[model samples]
Structures are given as C-alpha cells and as structure tokens.
Target: MDNLTHSLVGALLGQAGLKRKTGLAMPTLIIAANIPDIDAIAVLLGGDEHLALRRGITHGPIAMVLLPLLLWGIMLWYDRWQTKRGARPEKRLPVDAKWLLMLAYIGCLSHPLFDWFNSYGIRLLEPFSSQWFYGDTIFIIDIWLWCALIAGVWLSLRGERRGQPSWRVPAITSMAAIILYIFANGLITGRAEQLTGRAVQSQFGIVPAMVVANPVPVQFWKREMLWRDSNHYGQGVFSAPDQVVLDPKIGQHEMSNTFALAELSKDKNAKAFLFWSRMPVLREELREESKVRILSDQRFGNPLVQDRFRVVVPTEQDAK
Candidate 1:
C-alpha cells in the first residue's frame, strides 16, 4: 500500500475514537503506521537492492515487537520534553503510557496487513524465513480505497466539530466498507485464479506451477491473470463466472539455459533480482554483435515497464 493510504488508515483509527486514549494519540498512530517502511531506505543502494530489502526485516516479527517499543519510547519522551519546557497545551489529555504503547502496536500492525493486500508481496517472516507472501487482492495504489477513507475522515471530523452525538459513525462506517471491499476482492482473486488455472490446463494442456490474479485500476471486477508452468509463461483476462481469455503471446521463454542463468547469478544485481523475482523470464537480444541477456519478472515484463524491473547480463554466446 502507498504511504497516503497508510496515513489515512491511522487517521481513520484516530477518528474512530482511538484519539481519546492519550495525548498525541493521533500523531502516534499516524507515525507508527508508517514505521515499518523505514526499510525503504534500501533504495539508496541502487539496482535491485530495494527489492531484496524493502519489506524484509522491518516488516517481520522481530521488528514488529521492537518498532512499537521504539515509537512508544519516543512518544513518551516527546510528551515529557514538552511538559518540561512548559509548552504543553493545557487542554491536552494526560499521556497514558499503556495506551500509547497499545496504539503504537495497533498502528504498526496495520502496515503489514495492508501491504499484503497487493500483488507486490511482502516478507512477513523476513530474517527468520525470507519467504515472500502475496494476497493479490488489490492494486498497489487503489483510488477507491483512498476516496472512501478520505470521505470518512472528513465527515467524521466535521461531525465532531459540530458536536454531533455520533461523530465517529462516518469513520466506523468507512472502515467497515473498506473491510467488506477487501473481502470481496479476495473472493474475486481466488475465483479468477481457479477459473484461469482450469482454462490453462484444458486449453494448453499444461498445469501451471503458479497462477496469480493481479488487480487492475478502476475495474475492480476484472483481473489480469498471469500463469507459469515449468516451461512457459502466459497471461489471460478473467471476469466473473466464465470469462477467462488467454492472451495469444504466450511463450516458452522461462529459461532454456540453466548454465547461463547460474553463471549470470554471480553478478550482484542479477542475484538480488532473482532473490526477489517470483516469476522470472529470460530472453536474449542482439545488439552490435553482442548477446544481451535480459531478465525480468513476468508481472512487470511488458515493453513499457521492462527497463524498470530488468537486469541485463552480457554473454559471449547466445543462450540455447
């Protein structure tokens, strides 16, 4: 999920009445919600390092425990510092250490849950297992979710300002709606994968080793399904009861040369990319009499975005 969505979730939690628990509760929630993303600094290392480290240890169990504690300490110190300087607001509620810690944990936990809803995947058990987990239920940046959350927070805040009896109703309703939407999308993804898998087996006579239903923008009912068998990769369009239309550009380009792939893995970028790529496809290009091995993940391997997620290796001979 994007940072704005994460921030909105924290705001929604606050508006849903968690704000009354302690001083600076809203800020604590918002900050804690984005704490796990501290691993985003991995981008500075360049190449595919971000993919290797982005959602790893910072989103795992160990960081889950330590991060909230760290945020709790910082919030406690902030409150004390403000009071010591005599700059604390008089109407501010007393800071409750227990409540602050609880809010921190709640906000931090929400980060990984929302992240898992997208097809990009996350390492829930990072340092301990290094396994990737995917939900494939929603797009990375969902406009619908943003609109609902924003409306809820705005309405709730307005009602509160007007001293309405049920000021939190809007936020609560929005949260409920978001939950239902995610559940419905999950059902859609599962059904799409099932239908596409069956169609792939029946039409192509190949049992896919993995099938993913990737959510697209705007049209939530539709999915761009990508499937891969041991030898080939293919895609299809899936909608509702019986719409599974396979694309005609399916190819047996997974990896014909295991030796070449192994040799290329010696490079740092290729290794990191392979470590992160769920469905990698390799193809060769001829340029200036040199064989350029282009490796990319099937999800974002299209021509337009290939450069963004690709690693090129120079090979003396063409890979067979």
Candidate 2:
C-alpha cells in the first residue's frame, strides 16, 4: 500500500476513538504506520537492492516487535521535549506509556497487513525465511480505498469539531466497511484464480505451478490473471462467470530452459532479482553475436511499463 493510504488508515484509527487513549496519538499512529517503510532507504543503493529490501525484515516478526518499542521511545522523548519548551502540561492529554506502546504496535502492524493485500508480496517471516506472500486482492494504489478512508476520517473529524454526540461513528463504520471490502475482493481473486487455472489447464493442457489474480484499477469484479508453468508464462483476464480474455499480443512467453536460467542466475543482479521476484520469467536472446539474458517479474510487467525488475547480462563475446 502507498504511504497516503497508510497515513489515512492511521488517522482513521485515531478518529475512530484511539485518539482519546493518549496524547499525540494521531502523530504516533501516522508515523508508526509508515515506519516499516524505513527500509525504502535501500533505493539509494540502486539496482535491485530496493526490490530485495522493500518489504523484508522491516515488515517481519523481529522488526514488528522492536519497531514499536523504538517508536514508543521517540514519542516519549517528543513529549519531554515539548514539556521542556514551557508548554502547559494540562493543555494536552496525558500520554500513557502502555497506551503509547499499544498504538505503536497497532500502527506498525497495519503496514504489513495492508501491504499483503496487494500482489507485490511481503516477507512476513524474513530473517527467518525469505518466502514471499501475496494476497492478490487489491491494487497497490486503490482509489476506492483512498476514498473510503478519507471520507470516513473527514466526516469523523467534522463531527468532532462540531461537538456531535457520535463523532466516531463514521470512522468506525468506514473501518468495518474497508475490512469487508478487502474480504470480498479476496474471495473474488480466489474464484478468478481457480477459474483461470482450470481454463488454462483445459485450453493449453498445462498445469500451472502458480497462478495469481491481480486486481486491476477501478474494476472490482475483473482481474488480470497471470500464471507460470515449467516451460511457459501466461496472462489473461477474468470477468465473473467464466469470461477469460487472453490477448495474443501479450498472451504468453516460452520460459527459458533450466540450464540457461541457472547460468543467468549466477550474475549478482540476477541473483538478487530472482530472490525478490515472485513470478519471474527469463528470456535469452542472441544479440550482437552473444548471449543476452533478460529477467523480469510478471507481476509488474505490461506493455506500457516495460521497465520492470530487469537485469540484462551480456556474454563475454558481446563485451568484447
């Protein structure tokens, strides 16, 4: 999930009445919600480092426990700093240490939970294992989620400002609705994957090793289905009740043989990419009288977005 969505969820959590539990609750929640993304600094290292580190340890079991403690300490220090500046203590709600710790954990946990809703995947048990987990239930950036959370927060804040009797109702309702929406999408994605898997086996006589139903923008019932078998990668679209649309132009690609892929994987970039990629496809080409290997993950590849997590390795003959 994007940072804005994460921030909105934090604010909604506050507006839904967590704000009453401690001082600076909103800031604590919002900041903690996005703190796991501190690993995004890996982008500065360039190449596939970002892909390798993005949702790994920072979202895993160890960090999930330690990050909240770190945030709790920061929040405590912030309150002390404000107090030292001569601000009247009575002007702010008391910051309870226990509540601060709880909010920090809540906010931190929200990051990975929302991230797992999309197809990009997350390493929940990282440092222990690097296995990737995908929900395939929502787009990375869903406008519907933005609208739902923003409206809830906005309405709740307005009602609170107006001193209404039940100001938190909107935020609470919105949270429940968002959960249900995610659940519904999960069911849809599962059904679409099942249908697409059966269809691909029937039509192509190949059993896919993995099949994913990636959610498309603005079309909740429609999904772009991608699958991988031993020798090929395939993509199609699924509309409810068995409508499968496979475009010939971008329909499928022959997966490179194991030996060729093994050779390519020896490259440093290829190794990092393969470790991070959940649905990788390798292509070998004879270009400029030498072997050129290109590897990309099918999850983010499309005709428009051709610049995926790609690593191109040229043979010594081409380098000469």
Tens-place lDDT per residue, model 2, 216-302, is: 888888899898776677889999656887644333444546676667666677778888888777777887667887888787777
Model 1 over residues 1-320: C-alpha lDDT tens digits? 99999999999999999999999899999999999999989999988767888888999999999999999999999989999999999989999999999999999999999999998889999789999999999999999999999999999999999999899999999999999999999999999999999999998888998999989888899998999887889998998756999987778764767887887787788888888888888887887887888888878855777789988887745434
- Per TM-score, the best of the predicted structures is 1
Best model number under lDDT: 1
For model 1, what is the error of residue 180's alpha carbon versus the real structure, in angstroms, after optimal superposition? Answer: 0.4
Candidate 1 stretches with Cα past 4 Å from truth are 302-304, 316-320
The per-candidate count of clashes, in order, stands at 0, 0
Evaluated at residue 169, the lDDT of candidate 2 is 100
Q: How much lDDT does candidate 1 score?
A: 0.91
Q: Which ten residues in a row have the lowest lDDT in candidate 1?
A: 311-320
Query: Could you tell me every candidate's TM-score relative to the true structure?
Result: 0.96, 0.94
Worst 10 residues of 2 by lDDT: 247-256
